[model samples]
Target: MDLVLDAPERTRRIHRAAARFCAANGWAPLSEVPLPNGRRADILALLPDGSFRIIEVKSCARDFLTDRKWTEYRDFCDALLFAVDADFPQALLPEDVGLICAASMEDWALLRPPPAHPLAPARRRSMLLRYAMLAGLRASAAADPEAGLLARMALRLE
Candidate 1:
């Protein structure tokens, strides 16, 4: 039988499944936490030494395409892990980002470099931060372009 769920419900299931996985893996689950650079991440995790990592969870149909924001989420953290449903084809994910299948809270296969990723680590970090800032500005601009200009200026200063 095909069990169809709404988008929000699917996302909630994904989050819960990931939370269970984190707990099992000895990682502490944290709600929205501010990054060192002032950006807020969806989930912040603490390692044994107290280091941190960020996770961004997404839920879509088996054949659905990823939204553009996926790129922005990668920038705001040391590493990026995506929690997705198992039905989605893993091939759709980009190289360099970690992947976790949410149904069983299991670490799905990691996305490997198809033929070696060209961007250096430092360059990727910079790109992610810039993309995130632009994304935030774009959201603000949708409401009010003047506010977006101010937000963009403030982000640039930081």
Candidate 2:
């Protein structure tokens, strides 16, 4: 029997797999990260070597084809990768980007590794700070939702 998953379920699976992969590889991965260009990355991994990697999750052909902004993420990170379900057509994925086949959180494999293109020192520092702040906010929110809001407001005031 063939099994078909909807977009949201596919996305959740992809994210869970990406998160597991990142943790196992000693990288801290964040979801729905906002970039300075107003683009939000699906998964932004902070590598142990002080580099950043962005993973764009594609659930299906339509999701992959319709996104024109994925290229812009390259400017902000050292590597750009695409995470998709096992059933996704690998040939449809771009050759320039890396690929990961994720069937579930526990069953995912890296099909390709993206070439390293390190960001400039200044941009790297800026991105790192942004990542840190976002992570901190997330942690705070998890601890106390109201405190998290106040913390964000204070940061904005500064």
Candidate 3:
């Protein structure tokens, strides 16, 4: 029998694997990052070169097809990548974007590199500021469980 994972689980697996791969490559990966364009990036990473890269995870064909807004993400990052399972169809992905294939939790590869279009200096500065702020906030939250619980409870809608 073939094993299969639900969409959310598969997306999480791909995200984790992508983070592992990115870390090994000297990038700090942050998931569920909000971009200025109002789209949530699956994984926004701080590159060693002081730039940013966004990796979008597609759990299935429908997931990729339904959300074609991935292009808008390029305005906020130096490069864009699509991270998907090993069995995902390569043809469906845009040729200009980079590709990531995650075979296992700790095993993955960047099959292609996206052509770099450097972000404008001013835009980069603004995006970097927001990224640092978000990272610091997340770190503090993780360090303080009581505050985290309180924040979640307070933010929850009735």
- Candidate with maximal TM-score: 2
lDDT tens per residue, model 2, 1-158: 96677789878888889888889889999999989888999999999899999999988889988988999999999999999888888898879998888878788888899988989999999999999998999898899999888987887511
Give the worst 10-residue stretch by lDDT in candidate 2: 149-158
lDDT digits (tens) for residues 87-135 of candidate 3: 7888999999999998779889999998898999999998788787777
Candidate 1 yields a Cα-based lDDT of 0.61
Q: What is the RMSD, in Å, between candidate 2 and the native fold over all Cα?
A: 2.1
**In candidate 1, how many Å is residue 140 off?**
30
Per-model TM values vs. the true structure: 0.57, 0.93, 0.90
Model 1 regions lying over 4 Å from their true place = 34-40, 61-66, 105-158
TM-score of 1: 0.57
Error of 1 at 149 (Å): 29
Ranking by lDDT: 2, 3, 1
What is the Å distance of residue 88 in model 1 from its true position?
Answer: 1.6
Give the best candidate by lDDT.
2
- Which model is ahead, 1 or 3, in terms of TM-score? 3
Which digits, one per residue and each the tens of the lDDT, describe model 1 over residues 1-158?
A: 96887888877777777777667778666645545455655565554544345666777644236355545544444566777777667677766777777764455333331122234567556645554565566767889989988886776522
**Clash count list over all predictions:** 0, 0, 0
TM-score of 2: 0.93
